[model samples]
Target: MKALYFTADKMMELRDIAVPVPKKGQYLIQVKVCGICGSDFEGYMGKTGRRTPPMIMGHEFAGVITEAPEGGKFKKGESVVVFPKPFCGTCEYCKKGLVNVCTSGICMGVLSADGAMCEYVAIDEKYLIPFSPEKLPYDIASMTEPLSVAYRAVYKISDEELQASDHIVVIGAGTIGLLVTAMLSYRKAKHIIVSDTQEFRLETAKKMGAHTVVNPASGDFEEAIKKATDGKKCDFAIEAVGISATAESSLDALKIGGTAIWIGNAQKIVSINMQKIVTTELSVRGSYVYDFDGFKKCVELLQNKVIDVSSMITDTYKLQDGVAAFKALENNTDGKMLKVMLEV
Candidate 1:
């Protein structure tokens, strides 16, 4: 077996390693496609402390099962998408169905756990969701993890609030931001406003059903949001960029008592307008990764063509070209790259 290892900051190496053997209740999956996430990029750059060095770094992957426990719920030759986060069922958070935040859980590819940036991975049955490759390609199926993040972020707001709101804004046109826009489109949001510094991403947001796309690099972002909403601002704002400017802009683009869902966590801390939030009664909520049900829902949504993400995959590289893949994302100054996939 071969594996791509994140050896250090801005460094990756492909090395030959022994294949993993499946445990008693685990399934051995031969990875087909894996997508590099924003967090992975941060790890590559040594920006986030979540991922350490000398580990396989990939969680959004899809593969075919080659070995499984006898008479298990899934069998050999089954195509599956990994949930990536394996949680202890006995944990308090897991008992409450908040498995995403289970204290005893470990997210594959983050920290010390070796993930699927390799030829194979042995995943427990509880973390695998079987899917048909005919309905969803391996590359697209690998996006289930990020799509689930988008789903949970959009659905964080209640149905009543989402329907009652006339204006909604999504800050940042990255993968999560674009998917959030698509989910808003699926929910039939009245006016979808997407903001980003990159014009290419703004254009892509338009293609993803954004009613108004604003480039902060062009003009004032808050003014653009106000103009787009006819001076009412937005009823809801989803911040997908975890920087200080974008996080503040999400609050600035909202009307009184508007809700802001913080989905991106690139920055561990960002300054915000506390007085404005207090005076306007604004609500800011942090949305983390998705639970099992959310992941399953995203899988179904992708398989059913409810959310078309084929365009989101901007580039693909062979597993052996892992370093080039990371460099491509690192040097994506024009913002043309959206999601980069590695074919194993």
Candidate 2:
């Protein structure tokens, strides 16, 4: 089997590896597609500590079942998508059905474990969701993890609040950001404002249903956002850029008594207006990766055509070309490239 691994110096390298067999409660999948995520690039650059050296690097993958143990729900030749999150079911958080925050949770690819970057992977049956390529293509199915993350963020929003048709701002027009905009559009938001420095990504956001797009790099975005909204301010803001500036922008755009959901990982501590939160009653929430239900719903949406995950994939690469693929992602060379897949 061929696998793309993170070397000691934090670069992706293709190498021949041993094929894994299914354990008692696991299934062996013949990997069809694996999408490269922003975190994957960060891990490649040594910014994310979750991915150690000498490990396969991929988590969002879909494929056909090559082997299934006795009594498992999946059988050989069945197509499926993996959750990628390997968590202990015995932790306090897991006991409360919040397994994503389990104390000993380990995400495949990002952790020191063999991931879907290879020709085959032995995954636990509990985290696999069977699907057909007829509903969604293999490359789109590879995006189930990140789509699930965006879905979980929206799932956390209150139902009553969703019905309020409040103005919403999504920072960053990347994969998760675009998906968040689509979800908000489906939720019937009064206005969906997407902000990013890249005009191409902003245009992609418009195609995905953003009512307003702003280039934060052009000028003071807060005033533009305010002017665009007629001084009403966004009722809900989401930070998808995973940086200090975007994180603070999410806070600055929110209306008094509104909610700001930070889905991005802040590499450094970001200053915030805590006084405004105290005076205006603002709510801040941190969203993690998906749980079982979130992944299921993401697949359902993809299957039902409620959202188009396929269009988000703009490029593909073979395992041998992993280095160039990651480099293209880093440089943002292609216009509006949302997701890149590695063909194993």
Query: Which candidate number maximizes TM-score?
Result: 1
Model 1 lDDT tens row, 117-226: 99999988999899999989999999999999999999998889988999999999999999999999999999999999898898899989999999888988888888
What would the per-residue lDDT of candidate 2 be over residues 145-256, giving only the tens digit for each residue? 8888888887777878877845889998888898888888777777899999888888889888899999988999999889878998988898886777787788889888
Error of 1 at 307 (Å): 0.6
Model 1: how far residue 214 lies from native, Å: 0.6
lDDT for 283 (candidate 2): 90
- State the displacement of the C-alpha of residue 139, model 1, in Å, after optimal TM-score superposition: 0.7
lDDT of 2: 0.83
Off by over 4 Å in 2: 266-268, 333-335
Q: After superposition, how far is residue 33 of candidate 1 from its true place, in Å?
A: 0.3
Supply every candidate's count of residue pairs whose N, Cα or C atoms clash at under 3 angstroms: 0, 0
lDDT of 1 at 8: 92
C-alpha RMSD for every candidate? 0.8, 1.6
lDDT of each: 0.93, 0.83
